[model samples]
Target: MLPTYSPYEGGHDAPELRMPTGFSRNVPERRIHSHNDYWRDVPVYTALSHGVLSIEADVWLNPKDDVLYVSHSVAALTRARTFQRLYISQLVDVLERANVHDHETTFFNYVDYYSQENEREPRRLWTSFYEGNMTPIRLLVDLKTRGNETYHAVVRELAPLRERGWLTRWNGTHVVPGPVQVLLTGNGINADVRAQVAPARDRDVFLDAPLLKLDETWLGVDGVKYGWNSSLAPMASASFSSATSWTGRRTIDPATEEAPLAALISSTQSRGFETRLWSSPRWPTHVRDRVWRTLYDLGTDWLDADDIEAAAAF
Candidate 1:
């Protein structure tokens, strides 16, 4: 599910099942800003078991490493928890030995949520994932800051990789089947990304302009469980929604789905964009076919399902 605020509702987010059938979240490495010491060992079991479209992470490139490592927080960077941890599984060797995945998407929301800064020069996380048998997942890289520095750094790292067909643009535009795409999202995008959208689109990676700003009626519970001060005076009506931060802290009450869904639908209709909402599993458990049918009912263009929650429950 495209990181929904808690209090879950209905649609496709079925963490109980995972992927194509069940729903799970696949954000960027930067946001995964938790702890590499621990997360580095185990892969996202839920993503593997359930099959999320993409995974998330907050990447910080060590100015020195030229060697990319994964650490949600800069403080956590160490020899033990390197981003190339993917190679620990020999997925890279096997590939030197082959593959990238289906249309499955992975969103990399960069920039530390708490501390907004790009972590120096880091290797491409996508390249690391590919080395780990990640099957060329469609990756959307959100530039936390230094949109140019981060984007260019990432793209620079991707040149050879893309040439090998291991990576492409995220937005699902790169015509190459099983190609991974890179996209930019995040507050940093507001100031500079607009100009590059056309060029990025040309390269196969699309840029997501500022989304809704979080506020009172707008509401956002993801970060800090009910973030306030949605719209900034300087940037009034941009797409970035501050009131509705997207994280795991809280969720918008399903009763509040109408407006959000309407806005989402509008985004889809206008930009031909796609998003994922983790549907609350309670409804499906209570009525069986509650979620899937809801998507069918709503005419969701695309979604990830599992075990026919809606079909079996209802």
Candidate 2:
């Protein structure tokens, strides 16, 4: 008879038995936005792990050092924590593994051996990178530095992803969706550069519109009237306070928020742009939960939050 095995006793400790299965990556993407994501314990991975695909990185272009440093403030900037190291390179690695094809094999054969036509042909069809969670991960690059140079610097740094066809780009006439969508936020996009790129069918970066003022034909402060569309600003945002003052007190009065919030959401969505609201009520955990649920009910595209885990769970 086999040795009497005690239920509590560990049998032959096998490696598979000793190590538990890896965590699931199939967690559905939540509308949660990870604000100032670099501050998190592990940057991009932290939010991704929490099923929050929208992550913001406040990048300051250090003119002297010529480095795009990711941080909330200049005082926190460090060379070791640059955006390339933390986000871009890591994304390349993740997508490379996810591609599931031999990079060594040329995708297009210059000369087809099987065909007597001697014409070029696809040696192996290009495979689109499959995001395990099947969510379009968005990277909100908040420009801490204002200038054409700084904007261009951020664009240059995106080459690793851009070259790999992983970045969402605008073709001459329309926008082509990619695995990662990059939105440039903080201080409007350079006007001159926008004008130049506006005609071009394809571009790697996008502008973040001020949703609160999107409907305004006349500028409140500058008194400048301008027409805007989806190509110019594919994503729009506003402060939570702009919509309502329900600061985590009593339940949000539908009477107060229903009309205004509905109009804002509808108008923004009509223009083919997603909407986001930052500076949401955070105090009183219950109020935060209520706000999160309210935003969900409103069908807000991206629910912005500093507490990524909590928001993702919500």
Candidate 3:
């Protein structure tokens, strides 16, 4: 049965708070995705300073008051740590001052240069200004409340960024990239509900699909194969623990676990979605470092990490 927020229905008609303009810190971002980002001392800026490409914010909505709070757990929520305050507004503040260079133009020009030079070596593209690198940052919003309702509220609060063309969106034909791609995860919006929202004119937000579901039998499975597409999921991810039983005590044996991990990453990438592995071993001293090294050596697209400094260095 669909859960209803009845008595609290009319209580949440508060006006949306306006936010300040965003600014940019010029730096080259790493592939590290800082998990539980709200727990950081400074939230978004802390990850940004470390050159982390992605940051996560778990949002909880109070049905009675209609406020979205950012917290790792509901018990830790407070009005001061709101989604609008920490993430949405901060994003606006950074993106407002983002380097307005033409990435598409520069990219094509670089490709042409490589082709003209007849260079076989793959080229790396990094925009270097007087200050730092200017790459698009990703914001992963983990929904901790009711899916549909919270999804709608999240969309509503993103109007400022949406108006400025900072949020990623799916037009009817293609996925238009933006400065900040709002990826929805946790208890995501229902599939049927997503379908309804998928075709809207200004649909910029996207879903973070679960990579764990894609296995050898995915193609033959009913309902599993559906709703997985580039427009919906630019990236899909799974927990590292789910893929293997290695706890960092002993070295990971490639003979037993390599094929499956390879298959999962390769399969997901083949489907046009970037892959991420989270919930990896983080302690026991050398174990954490080893696990990070293994993941890096394996060429996973994004590293789900809590230690920003270590990930940045790695």
Candidate 4:
């Protein structure tokens, strides 16, 4: 039904073109979170190509070697698919190339000076695509093993990015935005993360707030009621099915369903945390589209999507 054209359609050689250092140039950044990003053919590159700013990786700590392996389960993990190799290293490479300039010596000196002064905004990943946009991309690490041990492993593995001043961090009083923001989630992550980062003057790791429990209070180290703030947990998430009763049958009820949903989203956003609802219905394409539209209309910050291309197009 469609005509096909060959590279040398007219019997002439195809022109050669060199790829630019800024490979993602002109790609508009999207709020879509690439769920199970490691499942992609090329992981981070696939999502980045679609302008998906947020990505997630499920990690397990191999106690033997003290390396973090990325996988949905232990059986799926391989030595080649490490957290450092797939994420941290790749990010460092991309950022290094993106921030590269003709005056390397001068640039490094200025960056170092700014780091000492604590007044510099690190050039973010998106700068490679849209130069000068310093907004950090989200990297959600779901710990599938023992929380504290695994969480620490993640921190250690982030050294490459940390050493380069490319990680968003809490500087005792405020949050310093960087090129990459790592949010720790899943088992055993909460207390350990809080204990470590809460006391440090400059800590890079953060916690993912529980969307449903955003209003609840927890006992702090001092035995006082501690509430979650953007500095500690910048984003909150929940299962879509747990949050709503809609099964993609009829339209979402404006009064009962929509109102509370909107209120919850408002509450989360009001506290400076972005809201993301995962585990939404994906089957029945029309239903998925409707729900996505509804969530977007209701002001959900990040769309958790398995299909990065479709979400980016949306």
Best candidate, TM-score-wise?
Answer: 4
lDDT agreement of model 3 with the native: 0.70
Q: What is the lDDT of residue 225 in candidate 1?
A: 26
CA RMSD per model (angstroms): 17.0, 7.7, 14.2, 5.5
Tell me how far the alpha carbon of residue 150 in candidate 1 is from the true structure, in angstroms, after superposition. 2.2
lDDT of 3 at 297: 75
**Top of the candidates by lDDT:** 4
Clashing pairs in 3: 21-93, 22-92, 22-93, 22-94, 23-93, 23-94, 168-204, 169-204
Q: Assess each prediction's global lDDT (C-alpha) against the native.
A: 0.36, 0.70, 0.70, 0.79
Compare candidates 1 and 2 on lDDT and give the better one.
2
**What would the TM-scores of all predictions be?**
0.45, 0.78, 0.76, 0.85
Scored by lDDT, model 2 comes in at: 0.70
lDDT of 1 by residue, 88-184 (tens): 2222332332222333322333213312432332222233222222334434343433545555555565554456555443332333323244444
- Model 1 whole-model lDDT (C-alpha atoms): 0.36
* 2 or 4, greater by lDDT: 4
Q: Model 3, range 1-314, lDDT digits (tens) per residue?
A: 33443344353341121111123234556888998787786778888877788989899988987778888787898878888888888777665444333533343455355445544432222221123233457788888886577887788888888887666667667665566788888865455445545445457788787787643222211333345676777888888888776676777778777666777778788888888988787786488888888777777899888888887877
- Model 2 Cα displacement at 208 (Å)? 1.1
In lDDT terms, how accurate is model 4? 0.79
lDDT (10s digit) by residue, model 2, range 1-314? 45754344465553333311123235566777888687775777777677777888888888887789888887887778998988898777656554534333334342253234423321211122222233467888888887767777888999998887788788667666666888888843445445444454568787787887665432222334444567867788878888666675666667776667877888789888889989888878888888878877888898889888788767
* Ranking of all predicted structures according to TM-score, beginning with the best and ending with the worst: 4, 2, 3, 1
